[model samples]
Target: MVARYVVSPRGGRRAYPSIASALRAAAARGRPALIEIAAGRYEESLVAQGDVRLVAADGPGSVVVNQLRGTVLQTYGSVQVDGLVLTNRDTEYDVVSCWQGSLTLDNVEVRTPGGVGTHARPNTRATLRNSVFLHGRTLFTASAGTIERCRFTDAADNAVAIIEGAQVSVRGSRIEGSRIHGVRVCDARAEVVGCELTGTGNAALMADTRAELAVADCVITAVHAEGIMFIEQSRGSVDRARVTDARHGVGAASGADPVVRDSVFTACRDTGINVQTDARGRFEDCRVVGARNIGVFSTKGGAPEVHGCHISGGNVGVAITEGARGRFTRIRIEDLTTTALRIFDPDSTGVFEDVRVDRCPAGLEVRGNGGTTAEVTRAEFHDFDQAAVALAGQCRVTLTGVTADRGMLGLGIGEEAQLRAFDCRVTRVSSGGAVVFGSARLIAKNLTVSGSEALGICGRNSALLDITHGEFTDCALVGAAFDDECTGRLVDCSVGGTGDMAVRHNGLVDLASLTTSLPVVRNREPVPLPPTIINVINIINQKIITGPTIHGDAINNNFAWGNDHVIQNQPTEEGPRT
Candidate 1:
């Protein structure tokens, strides 16, 4: 048999005067119970050890249960509360706690001044729907639960906290004006979908300490910290999310990797996506716009695999620095105030393929020690005010099938940088097409430097050049110029439509071919020279039917110091986020 009880403050209509008295009677009866409270204020605390449903006789907000210091309600068995207001001004306890069994709250309002509004402990499940939590956080400590259509506002702590290996699913929730994080997961996991988190003092969503948080169709805005932060080896994924006006749209560090897909980050103060300290996040099909500093920043063992992304209106597009290795493919970077892609410092290598950079001052800049290396293939640099591709410091880079159009300078290699360009085209550059200085080395094979406003190829300041089958045409100035103690072998190269001299050598340039070759622009790679042939006869006497001679042991020994990979990057996974 079931028992029913109605309670009021003054025992109206022969009902119990207090909720505790009725609960005591219901417990004495020892049966499944339903307790209906009248429409009035109740200054009380109640504990239910058995199954019970506590509801207001009237609609929601008609019954106000307020506790001054301690928990207002604590349940050990399955409990359901509906159409009631639970308020507590406790400083050291949860207002409503489910300790042993499940709790279902529907159309309930909880307001706690200094304690948790609701706490679901381990081995418990909390089902909250259409509830309002104000000035308190809902804690799921080592528990499992689902929250649907809930509102959390003005939380003193995180709006919702999932910790201690708990797992929760939150859907269609709105969290606003949180003093701390909107949602924080530590050593736990959560899946938040169709949620809006705004006005958070800290990160809107934080996954730390091996926590995994999956968010989809979410909007996070007005965050003082990062919109989404992953740290301490956390794993997570964000899909179809929009983040705006955060310090960093997404920040990952301490071995945390967040797989971000189909997301948009706009007007972030710092970098759009920041990965550091061994975090290897994969960002795909994302758009980062109006970032103040950089669009994508990966450094210090952070190797992000970014592809199919568009970045614009940032100071710099992407920066991979300080032992970070990244694989960037099909990335379009445009309209930046500074460089498009910057690879700097030691032990950092970037392999860029099918990348396009436009309207940036410096397109692709590589500056580091020999530990820094880059392999760029089929890159397009357009409308850059400065050099399209610039290499400085002591690094090595290889550019193959790269096209630079309408740039001030095409390729600028300086300061002990070694660059190898094969089947590359530099057209409509205002300055020189390929400029090598400051003890740099260039092994240019089958390159076309045409329609340059100035000289085609300029080598100066003790630079080394090994050019083979380089075709220069329609240059306003000289075709090729080597001055100031530059020494190299130019073999099987042609120059045409130069307003000045075809080939000008001002200093001691060891040219193997004084007589220019025919203007036959062969559509093929330059052949490697045999080492035995270069060792016996002088380079000048040999007809040299070949390309850049670096493959041959005779010439490879001259510039072999910058060819080693000091640091190898680990693999980056683009599979579905866990």
Candidate 2:
């Protein structure tokens, strides 16, 4: 309908700028209308009644709205402001407020004449796409909208704070020089993508108030505080992002579970990934290097997955204790002053599959009240002052395909530990050779120990030791010595020595086909296993009846022991021979 015109500052003299006149005309029409603002200085306050579109005749720096008092535009309905420069706005309140409306601003700017701290709500409710919100407390608050390709600099508070049931998408934006957080999203769903944020007092991106925020392909550098902080049951995921030179790269606390994947966090003052307060999350394929405290810390009942990641250069590479259970695979960590992996106090569960630590202070340290169970496979260690793997305090651990070379002690099974090492290699050590013991029970198979100074296998103050399929080569000391009530059964194993001693054991054996020239047992008694002898007799009877007993336990003398299974002598008429 051919709209009516009502010029503001309402005079017949036609005195205000054309923008004020056009707004008056659009309001007079009482419907959806377009206000064509010419390239000039419009000094006035605008209040929209209904749906309106404010179109500028020039670009962002051309068409200017010079407001000295305070607000420039306050709207009630859906509005669109395009291609305008709004300068010298109010520092007290907002320059533009879309209280009940949605705003779309393209190439628009709202800057204060004062310093960076300018407006309270620079642009609210608003989709500020391709806009520059400079010198404000907040660029915008999209309560239920999107903001794309926007830049917010020198903000007194958060550059962008999305709240109030709003699901905002801030993409391809830059938030820098913030007094507080760069982008804060709380009580809402937020997805921040392809953004660069730096120089924040708080976190670069903070997700609180039970919101789910996903940050992808973003770069956060030189953050004065944490790079990303997730709290209050917020489920956040940070992927393909880089967080460097921050106090903390990522922190997920207060019952929040945040996942970080394919991200790199380097040169952080605190931990690279710290999860506290029952935070259950996953970190896949991430690299955390040069952290001041810990590479990955899971405290207070947080169960996290750390897979295919590299953590290096920290006080502790991975500290999972105090009820923190972490599942790890393919984690390569090394070169730390204290504890490569520490699982202590209240029994943490860590499943390390194919994890390697090269030259750390203490390797795989576990202690405390509740026991930690780990399925370690294909793990290798080299060049350590202490034991390669140490387990203490009633813990149950299993090691398969583990190799330890050039260490003071290969494996230290502390008192009350039930450890099983299968197909493990311990070689080239000066002090303690394969094991220095204080364990309850230790079952080992296919153990290769070469060039050790002390006893090859020493289980002191421990109860049971089952060693099978072992090769102890070129050792001057006793190959197998069980002291302090330690008893073992050795079978199908060779203990070779350069000088004299071979299989100087203090244990018992049953039905062992020991190929060594020396006897398998030294001080302990040796007996025939009934199951082995019966199977042998049955095999001989079968050879007389038909053919050989192929794949029989007696043929190979199956004598493997693990942590899960009990090591027992074969049933005999001598009442369970040991």
Candidate 3:
């Protein structure tokens, strides 16, 4: 049986006069011992060993131990401290410390004046439950620990800091009014679950410098900087978090890649979620509401994959720029003041599939020169202002099953770019519909432009427009206009229904089986076709490119635009010239 020693300032009935004498007696007796103290204040520096249990006889808040020069209690054995107030008056000392032992604090309050509240060193194991800390950080250095149901307030620095390969788990803790980050984990692994962090001066939760973090069901609010950030090669996962009124809701930079899922960010001042500077983060099933700046910004080697997310009420919805690569699938962009999505990198494929953008000022933009082909599939744009869909900067863009409605312009390709559209439709266009200019090439198949107030399709400035099986209806001025060294070809195309002219041709244009209302057909004679040319267009728009040594795919023989296909030597209506 373990011996019990009673300690009281007023000595009576075989009780020790001071806690120090009681601890000396327990240590001399050896084995496991219990030191119960009466209601009093003891001024002493103590070292508890040999499986000691320090309990307050009159319960918590009754026993106060103030160490004036050093730690209040340093434990070397398995020590259990219950219902005691531990305080250190010196700034250079800690209230409670465990260096190479197991320590448990239950129902304890640590009040330190300019000192650490609780410290567990590299070889220690600490567990704190139902505790309170004030004006100091609960630090763990290369230690293994768990903090449960603890409250930390008015912290001088981070409320909890875990560093140097520490493995810690904090559950059901509230860290509020921290001067710096609420919780910082560097070069360690931390799992924080069911925690609430409020009013932090810096990032609410930060995992930096190769640390790993997994946070779930947490609330972070009123942060001066990022709510949750991971930087410097750190990777983590966040689930079901709510971040409100932060500068940036979530940020990943400098090789950090965090997969955040099912989170909501509200009223962020800057970008709601930012992945930049070689960071590759994935966001899935998240909602960003009322962001003042861009909703999602990825740039500078940042490659992010966002899936099944909704972004609403931001200045710009999503901006991917400066060699960044972004792939968005099943995303909803709603009611932004600026463009919905912009992709400026030349090497980015900009894969966007099953996206809906409503009431944005502009739609998707793919810009830059010598770019790989960007593929967008099943994208819908509604009520956009100038560019419902615009492709510029000599880039290559491919649109399949895309639709635009009730916009100022629907689908424009300019700036020497090349566009290949398949099964696309634009309706209720107010200003213009399907315009191509500036030495560009637009190869459209199964395209429909209906209910347009101005020109249905206009081509200019050496533009090559290949339209096959297209329907242009309800156009005002002209259905299809080609001019200024434009090479235009239309096969099985119809132009009618409330248009002034069916076809206005001022360039080198050839038409076959064109059904129109009033066709002013010029250059109707059959012209000999040119040779199979693999020239600038092939160089600008090709996935598997060919050079002088590597003979490319012949344009007319193998690849052709619909019925204008040419076989090697098959003689048809248009004789083979190859």
Candidate 4:
């Protein structure tokens, strides 16, 4: 008893002039049927199966289902098209064609000239509320659906295409001029909420096989590519997204594992979060500004986990190379033009904590062509012009409580590098306070070089220094400098207010229990007591009760042999002795 039909192409009373004779008298009243249609052009081609509505007495732009050749509405079991205006002057077919039923378009208005503007076949299930798909190419391919408050403009390709066992839910959507992807999930499962995608030629949200996308609070702007692109083994999560002018404002590669939170990637031409091949992503509290290149890029063997991130103007403010591996925490890299964390793969390994590098010229730049390893804790390097921790090839680093301020060079262990510093601190370094050359190896503990204007620890070729409990204060020059053929071991060391010389051996230095209030030991070229100097410690300018002689061929039976057994030469007392 519920079958109402009223067509009216301007006829008399109980009108039924067009709408295919009121859908053939409401399909002979077999069950559910509405069919209203009254106010304008209707060069129709409608076909319905069971429960059909097709109502638009005088609403959506006053009814206009202008079809030329194929589909202008061809549903199967349950269809409902309110306030109609579905077009198609034959650009190649679809203008609403839901094959196996369940199609609902509320305030509908699909004007297709270049084809598909709603074609949900293959287990069809579509629903678009307050819809509007204008100059289309691909405006829908939903298998299971819900596109609320929809509006897709010049869509030439994918403007919501969720194939392969789909499960779509696009909320409060708005995709403008999409020449390519503006939401395209293949193996399918999408949930794009509060969407707003603008002028996308490619990747303004794209997920491939094994798909699982969940974009929240989105606003993807002018994207030519990658404003969210998770490939192959897709898995996505982008929250609080902004993503401006994109090339890569979120791009997870083949082995995709995307989880970008609190996102804000501005003017990105390239890497503003790009995890490569063996992908593993997790970027939290994100904020990557003007990224022209790397503002978080994990390469081939990708493994990213950046927390509390804030990378600014990037050329390289986090670029873990080819064999990528990363785990940075509390990171804050500033105005970078180059090198503010670049760990080139040797076998790639990075673990940074509490990092903060300001005005970067170079802060934490480890290059490894074969063996790389990094582990920095509590890092803070300021105003770097170069060398605020820069290792070369075959790198291996470990710095705890690291701090290098006003750097020109504060920690630059060259090729063949291997550094292990604990409680490190190099302040006001305009030049050097930790510089080991090729064949580098520096092992320091509790090292503190204060106000360095130059050399407060500088080793040359064959460099290798093992310092334990060090302190060199107010150094303007030499307070520990070993030249070519370098080799060292300075234990319980201390040199204060050094402006000229305080331990400047040519090479092979082994000083134990050394204490200098300030002055000389500039033995530039005379260290021929080789036998590896079993023990030779007497470099005191101040308080030394006695304990400095046990040279090769061991002879220390209680220090009482002064008959040429050499254990007594304590009379070179100079000024400034503490």
Candidate 5:
């Protein structure tokens, strides 16, 4: 029962002056038609087929559809464009061109200086409410769509270009000043809710081939490059997103797999979430701030799973290289300028849990070409200037319940690195608390080194240090130090306030049971069987032999009489060699 036609340029009275004679008198009254256009410039180029209703009596700046070149409204079956103002001064074509149509645009305003602004063609179905698409190159190609309260301004390339098997739903949208891509899905399926993409040149949401994107509560700002770009086998899901100043904030490569939840990436110049080649990404409760480079970056064989993340002021906070693999949980890396967790190639693998590194220069940097494996659990390295866990070449690390405070070399095992520390705690370190050099291998068990100024466990060149149950107190110089062609084994060790020396060897050191309250053995070169001094406690002017040949039983040594404690082959009686 829809048939009402009234069009007027000036002379009214059952009007019908222009509007192509009221669409040929509503297609000779064939069926449903309501063409009520009044008030102004209608230099028209309109074409509709069966059911049409183009109503704009006084609203939409008083009706103007001035297509000076090609298409300005061309529908097929069912169309309803109410309160219109479509321009299209034509650099070539489209400004609203639906084909096998069911188009509905209420309060529409599509002003194009160059081309496409709403061209829903292949298996068409479009619906835009309270719309505005200005200065368009491509603003909405929408194969099947629903864009509510939209405003896509100054779009030169793509502001919503959902392709092939399209399913688009964008609510409360505002894509602003987009030169390249602000939402461009290929084998499409896009659902962006409460979106606000600002000043995007390249990628503010660009999902390629096998696209399926769902971005909720989005606010992507100043994106010069990737702020959400999922390539080849594209798959995306970003919730509560806030990406700012992006180069790469969520960029998944070839085999893309993206699931980023509760995201917040700010001031990103390079990578705040970049999973490469064999991509697998899943981040929950994420936040990466002020990233100049690498706040979560996995390379070639990428495997990323970061949960409860917070990385701040980054240079490299979480960077797993070439043959990448990463799995982090409860990570908190703060003020990182150099390395807070950087596991370089060599078939890389990193598994961290409850990691916390603060003010980093280098906190957990495992690099050595190709056999990198870092497995950390409950780690906390604070105020690191250099090495709070730095294993160089042939890296294989395993740390459980690790803690290094005020660090400057707390666990720095160099080339051929292999470290296994369990229940480790190194406090107030300046230079050394666990430093094994060249052919590095350190296997510690309940190691605790207090206020260390220099050597509390330090092994050199051919290093392989193994401490079972070690504890060193206020060590300013030496509590366990092995030299050049080093090799060590301190089973049940304990050293007190060592300002000078307590167990210092040259090459091969094996102390089964060593407990020194002050001085036990400090040999620079000579060593056969020194440190077996079990609980030697007589600290007056402590100097317990500068050369090592002191074998096991120093018989509960307690010498403090004008102390000249030098027990060298004391079997003259059973008094000192007990």
Candidate 6:
């Protein structure tokens, strides 16, 4: 026979005198029990030694349970607690702690004393739904648990920690006001979705040492340190998220393989994303802005895939250093005070291919002792104060189909550096044209320099200068000249306009073949022209520009170029050559 006990303060109730007596009577009956609690402050810890259901007359926050002792409810068997406000009476221990038994809680609130937990296991199991865990340290350290539709606040330590092959899931929650990590997965697999975390420590979500984490559709903000950290070979994935006001937004350390996509990091103090210590990662369709350090930093021989990202408003947009190799496609960096992209290799044996930049202080800044190879193609530069491309130390930099406007110096090459700028156009530059200062071999092909102050090609201690198949539209200075101790070879390059016979250099002028062909102009991209320029291309590039460009009107090219870059097709020559 099952026993039912109802306790109410506002009734002539002769059912039970106390809650303990009711529990004892129900347990003696050898059947399922139900205990109803009335609306009042129950400053007691109700222990569930067997299978029981505790129901409250009022909803959550009405029947308050204020516990000051160690653990609120110790579950030995199955227990169900619903619609209750479980508060801490300035407890020296955790407000609600569940042991190994299966516990189900709905519409509950677990509050602590605003102090750190002294024990290792502050709480365990602890499945909560539509609850609030507020003002606790080490609020949850579960062996296995699932928390959904909850809120956590004022936790100084880890809000949720899973260990020992535990599986934890937190969904649709708000975790905030933590000095340390919001959630840490150690030797566990955890999944978090549709949540927001703010004001945490080194990471909002951290996976350490053989742990795995998957985070999706979350917003992390106002953290002093990294928003997400993967360490000790942990595997993690972050998708469709936004992180703001942190140090490094996403950090993969110690050989961790993390995939990050469709994310945005704003106002990061350090690098927006960093891969260190042999970490392999992939980042796609991400935006990194307002960084004090680099936007993306890859170090320690890590291989990364950076695709379709707009990294701007930073000191250094991207830095590939310490013998790292990566493939970057359709990258754009703008409004940088320092180097937009820097590729540094100690041994100079790294490679950077198919990188692009626009509207940066310095589009490309390369420095290292290594002989690295880099290619910059189809890149546009605008409103830069320095050289669009700067090559220093022993490295090879190739520029093709690159355009720059109002550049201080088009290309700045240091000693022992090999540089090739081909099919490059520069407009409204006041300094020396396309090439400047080098001791290594230099080559310029089909280069157009217009409105510059100095020579088109100026070499200080260059070994060989090859100027071939070029057109100089308009220059404010001499077309192409080799300085003292510089050798030159001019083959089939057209030099039409000249700036001034300024500073006649004792070098040869090359005019191999003057060839004129009308430029094939077409509207390569769609443009409505924004009233205020919007940086929405990185998001769109994730969808469009997926293949090679074939013709003027390729069916699904879907490039969103600015209105100024759009040029209509010229009329074809139907009659004789006029």
TM-score of each: 0.88, 0.79, 0.86, 0.45, 0.45, 0.80
Writing each residue's lDDT as its tens digit, candidate 5 over 1-578 gives: 99988888787688888776777677777799998888788888888777988888888758888877898778888989888888877867888788876889888788888558778877778898887888774434447878888788878788778887788888888888788898888888988888899888898889988889989888988889988888898897999889998998888888888799988999899988999898887999989998898899998888979999999996889988888898999999899787888887587999999988899877887775547798999989898866687676677889999999987567877667789999889988775687676787899889998888766877766879989888888877767766667776888777778466665665266767666655544333322211221111110002111123333456544411111122222121122123
Candidate with the greatest lDDT versus the true structure: 1
Candidate 3 lands at a TM-score of 0.86
RMSD of 3: 9.5
Can you write out model 3's per-residue Cα lDDT over 1-578, one digit (the tens) per residue?
A: 88999998988898999887887888888879988999999898888887889999999879998877888888888899998988887778788889778899988999876558899999788999998998888989999999999999988888899999998999999999889988999999999999999899999999999999998999989888999999999989999999999999999999999999999999999989999999989999999998898888888888889999899998888877777778899989999987787777566557889999999977877777666457889999999866677777678888999999988667777767889989998888775567776787899998888888776777766788999998999877667766556777888888768776566665366667677655443333321111211222222233111223114343544321212222111112332122
Candidate 4 local lDDT, 157-269, one digit each (tens):
77778878688799988998878888889887989998899888998889998799999998988889888989898997989999898988988888889888998999899
User: Whose TM-score is higher: candidate 3's or candidate 5's?
Assistant: 3
- Better by TM-score, candidate 6 or 5: 6
lDDT of 1 by residue, 407-464 (tens): 7778878778899999999999876788787798999998898898776887766889
Which candidate, 2 or 3, has the higher TM-score?
A: 3
Q: Comparing candidate 1 with candidate 5, which one achieves the higher lDDT?
A: 1
Write down the lDDT that model 6 would get.
0.67
lDDT of each residue in 530-549, candidate 2, tens digit only: 23223222322332112353
Clashing pairs in 5: 346-370, 555-578
Q: State which candidate has the highest TM-score.
A: 1
* Positional deviation of residue 535's Cα in model 2 after best superposition, in angstroms: 47
**How many steric overlaps are in each model, in order?**
0, 2, 0, 0, 2, 5
- Cα error, candidate 6, residue 264 (Å): 1.3
